[model samples]
Target: MLATGLTFVAMNGIVRHLGTGLPAAENAFLRFAFGLPLFLPTLIPALRRGFPRDLWAGFALRGALHCLGVIGWFYAMAHISLAEVTAIGYVNPVLVTIGAALLMGERLSWRRMVAIGVALVGMLIVLRPGLRALGSGHLAQLCAAAMFAASYLIAKRLVERTSPAVAVAMMTATVTLALAPIAAAVWVPPEPWHYRWLLLAAGMGSLGHYFMARAFAVAPMTVTQPVTFLQLIWASLLGTIVFGDQVDLFVILGGGLMIGAVSYITWREAARRSPITPPIDVAKGA
Candidate 1:
């Protein structure tokens, strides 16, 4: 999860440094296009080994959810501070936790609720709804976070029945296909340097997802999730010192609260997950 955060931050930094002149759709397409080669080997095995057809519809739905998230995430990152984007967006884990309990009948204990409550406090610190002005970037971040949570939950169920590598490959390919026409129609001329960054974003995203897959293989969502909140700390530091982004008291306090809440929720979930291994296979190995 920490690795995923850094990769995402780096992807954002690369995209932002590339400037807003780049078309969002085109840039997004290019990233996944570049990612294709890296994923080819993983794809081979998954293709030969298929999931039940019944699961494909779920995969498509989840892919669409994730596609929306990727687009919003790119749009927000290109326009906002990397730290701000990262901080706001990383709350999906908490959302997933709540959603799972309600939807999946996953066991929920008081400890998880307390952890979630504390995390909400942290989010409020960053958002500071009553204290400050809100921007479109904030709105984009919120949407992206929610969509990401929905996508991951879908993926979680899908992973239980399919290979993680296959699930990721399908998402990338589907998103690329979905975005292609839109990107081509609105395409702007990109310099060689622009292409370089686009390619880098693709690599980071694919690698990030790969690491995430591996992490999930080793641990349950509850066990592995808290570590992901660490992304906020990376974002704050990266945004301030590296990007020279100005800091506000509310963001600091709110972000910390959010992290604390998320962390607590994760820790409790980890404790309560029962056995480390699934009575059956916990993961389809990467």
Candidate 2:
């Protein structure tokens, strides 16, 4: 999980660097395009084993949600500091909690509701709505978080019926195809050198998620999920070193509140679900 957090921050830095030149839509499309080859080995085996035909549509929908998240995330990265983007993104798990309640018929407890409220307060503090105007970047990140939450929920459902490898592979392929037309429409052919950067970003993202999946596979969510808070610190450090962005205390404070809320909610849910069975961890930004 620590490695996953570091790699995810690294990937975000690369995205910010690349997005300075590339259209976000094109960048998103390229991410999945280049990353698809990495998943081919896993995807091929899953294809041979086969899953219900009905689930393909769910995968496609999840892919589309992922595409939206990617587009918004890339756009946000280009326009905002890495720390700011990372902090606002912590709301994802909160949103995911709500989604599970609504979609999966999980019981919504008062503790979870209060945690969600606290998270929203933290978000407002980070945004400082009345004090400073919200930038498009902030709005985009918020939208991206919600989209990611939705994608996570759908992926969770799909995972019940199929392997994680298959869910991931289908999402990659579907997102690549879905975004291709838009990417091509606005696509400025990147310099030959840029492909190297894209490949690096893709590699980091793929490996990060792979490690994250492995961590969750081996450990309980109660143990693994809390470690994801390290991502905000990593993002803050990377922003300072790589991008020369200052670490905003407000962002840290706000993100800390959200992380605490998420952690508590996750623990509560895990305890409620089963004392014996390990709970599934929430997906983090990649």
What would the TM-scores of all predictions be? Answer: 0.89, 0.87
Query: Which residue pairs in candidate 2 have backbone atoms (N, alpha carbon, C) closer than 3 angstroms, thus clashing?
Result: none
Question: What is candidate 1's lDDT per residue for 1-286, written digit by digit as tens?
Answer: 7787678767777776765777667787888888988877877777687756777777778767777777777787777787678678757888887887788776667877887787777787777787778787788789889988988777777666666777778778777877788788988988888877788888988888877766655555665667777776777777788778887666777767777776665555557765643543644654
Weakest ten-residue segment in model 1 by summed lDDT: 274-283
The TM-score obtained by model 1 is 0.89
In the order shown, the candidates' Cα RMSDs to the true structure are: 2.5, 4.1
lDDT, candidate 2, residue 70? 88
How high a TM-score does candidate 2 get? 0.87
Pick out the ten consecutive residues of candidate 2 with the lowest summed lDDT: 277-286
lDDT of 2 by residue, 14-125 (tens): 8988766989999988888999999999888877877666897898898899899989999999999999999888777667767777877765668768977998898887
Q: Judged by lDDT, which candidate is best?
A: 2
User: lDDT (CA) for every model shown?
Assistant: 0.75, 0.80
Off by over 4 Å in 2: 212-226, 263-276, 279-286
Candidate 1, residue 4: CA error in Å? 2.2
**Model 1 misplaced stretches (Cα beyond 4 Å):** 48-51, 265-283
